[model samples]
Structures are given as structure tokens and as C-alpha cells.
Target: MTASYVFSVRFRLSPDAAVSVEPETFETTLYRPADPPGEDGWLFFRDNLWRGEVNDQRHARRLAEDALGVDVEAVEFRRFETDREHYDALKAAIADDLATFNADSVSEVLNKYFGSSVEVVS
Candidate 1:
């Protein structure tokens, strides 16, 4: 069976900031065999909270820091093995958004779910 991994990063806003702000967290995911393919060989997902390809942990961390507008204290990542059942369920959950991207296949659906970016290895 092919293996797919989800990469996640957690970040907290700087405590010393001028404005009072609550800490927030964000995450991004990348799929193997990305739709339309990528030069680095992975698909990326960009969201309001986070952006970057899964394989490039540094890029993900930088994206989080940029969003938070503060230096991140720590970053964490987790990987999961996905199967058709899980993938289908995920597709179902985000079906409406996928349609917005005019996704015709699973890869297209995932590409839309994340965002447009070339995958790269660290």
C-alpha cells in the first residue's frame, strides 16, 4: 500500500507584543502523488492559518511565524498513514470546497484542500 503523511506545525504568538493577543495554532498538510505533480514530488495545502508543502518543515515553520507576526517558540509535526476509506471520508467532509476548485479526481480534491505549492524535501 502507498503511504501518505500529514505534516502539522504549532506556533504561539510572541508574549512581548504590543497588542494583547491570545495564542493561536495552525497546521498544513501535503499528500504524496500530488495532483498535476510537483517538481519535488509532493502536493501542498495552503490555508488561512498556514501555508507550505508538507515535506518542507522549515517552510511550514516560516509560514507559521509569518502569520503569527511573532517568533515561534516551537514547531511540531505528526505523520499519519491514510487509506482510501479515510481519504474518502476527508473528501466528503470538504466536498463543497472541492467543488469550488472544480476538482474532478481525488488528487485534485486534495490539491484544492491544501493550496498551490511545489513540494520540496528538507
Candidate 2:
């Protein structure tokens, strides 16, 4: 079986090397293989996840490298998991985060972690 959800990769870029075309929100499509022992699920993967922002990680890294001259790493990703209820909760969490994200304190923390280039687009 396959499950889809929105994913985000937050990163920073050097001042001298950053892309003029900034991304608002990134999307990722997750594939849940039908198998037992699902408890062994690993959140991080090299590929097989699809995002509307760009292609594979290789492509995303290349874009960052070419445009910003820096390697873009996967800081964190938002996935709802294999359960429908959990997925819905994830969506709600995202929305709540968005609501409180623009606050001064939140921005401060986000800027510290993700830098000023932090952007959210869906």
C-alpha cells in the first residue's frame, strides 16, 4: 500500500549563495510497503519519497549546490504515519504550527534553527 503526505526540508544558505527563486512549501509522497513488523519502520530514507518542490534528494541537493553553493540536508520531515487518524492529527499539528509560527518568539526560534530563509508554501 502507498500513503501520501506533505513533507518539508528546512535548511539555510550562505548569503553570497542563495537561490532567488525561493520555495514556499515542499510536498513529499510516502510509500508504505505492505509488510509485517511495521514497528521497524524507518522515518528517514534515501529515496522513494516524492515532493512537489523538486525531484529526488540528488536533484534537490544539486539545486541547492548550484544555486546556493551549499549542500541542503534533510533537517526534518512531517509524516502522518501508516494510520489515518495519526495522519489527520499530523495535519492539524501543521496547521497549529502555522498559526503560531508567525509570532515573534516563534520566528526567533525558527530563524535560529532554519535561518532567515525559512519559508512555508503548500
Candidate 3:
């Protein structure tokens, strides 16, 4: 099972750039893996998100710029997409790591980190 934070990135393309595009502004998606809970990168939520949203737009754009090798102008979070199995596993892991987060329950952790932006797919 795998999960990823989907973001919509807007970037600028120079006129000298060799591409068959109409506009200078372009949009694309970048997936940041929401590593399995309790894993090394499990703190992604705490580091990058607040209330189910991106905490820093500029930082996110820089990340997109690095990944796309383009000048990113904006970044917007789309969704946290995952499967049922992965979601359940995350819940279980959160329950295990409750103390570190200083939260009372898994639901609280979810709310604080993800809000209502989670999308579970089959």
C-alpha cells in the first residue's frame, strides 16, 4: 500500500524554451510520498502541513521548482490520496506513535495534520 500528497504546481516557461506550449504559465502535479506511519519520513505531515493544508506555499514552490527544474510560481495542495489498506495502516501507526504527537487519539492527529483533504481510493 502507498500514499502520496498531491499538489498542483504552476510554473513559468521562458519564450526561449523549446516546447510546444501556448502560454507561459503551466500547471502540473507533484507527488510527495506520505511514507508509511512510523517510518523515517513519517513526520512529513508535521513538517509540511497544518490543518490538512500546506503550511508554507513558498517552500512548496521551491520544492516544485527543484523537482521540475523550472521556475515554480505557485503550489497548491490537492489531496492526500491512498488506499483503504494504507489508510488503516496509517491509523494504526498513529495510534502507536500518539505520545510523540502529544495528541489524545488518532482522529485528533488526523484532524491536526490532514483536516478534510484525505481521499481514500480503492
Most TM-score-accurate candidate: 3
Cα lDDT for residue 36, candidate 2? 21
Q: Distance (Å) between predicted and true CA of 95, model 3?
A: 1.0
Quote the positional error of residue 100 for candidate 3 in Å: 2.2
Q: Point out where model 2 deviates above 4 Å.
A: 1-51, 55-59, 62-82, 100-122
lDDT of each: 0.45, 0.37, 0.86
- Number of the top candidate by lDDT? 3
Residue pairs in clash, model 3: 52-114
Q: For candidate 2, lDDT tens digit of each residue in 23-77?
A: 5334333322312222234222212232312335665455444644444565233
- RMSD of candidate 1 to the truth, in angstroms, is 11.7
Show where candidate 1 strays beyond 4 Å: 1-70, 73-86, 95-97, 111-122
Q: Estimate each model's TM-score.
A: 0.29, 0.22, 0.87
Q: Candidate 1 residues 24-97, lDDT tens each?
A: 54444433332322223323333321222344556656755775565554443343345555445455645535
Q: TM-score of model 2 relative to the true fold?
A: 0.22
lDDT of 3 by residue, 9-41 (tens): 889886565655678798888898888877798
lDDT of 1 at 23: 40
Candidate 2 lDDT for residue 52 = 19
RMSD of 2: 14.1
RMSD of each: 11.7, 14.1, 2.3
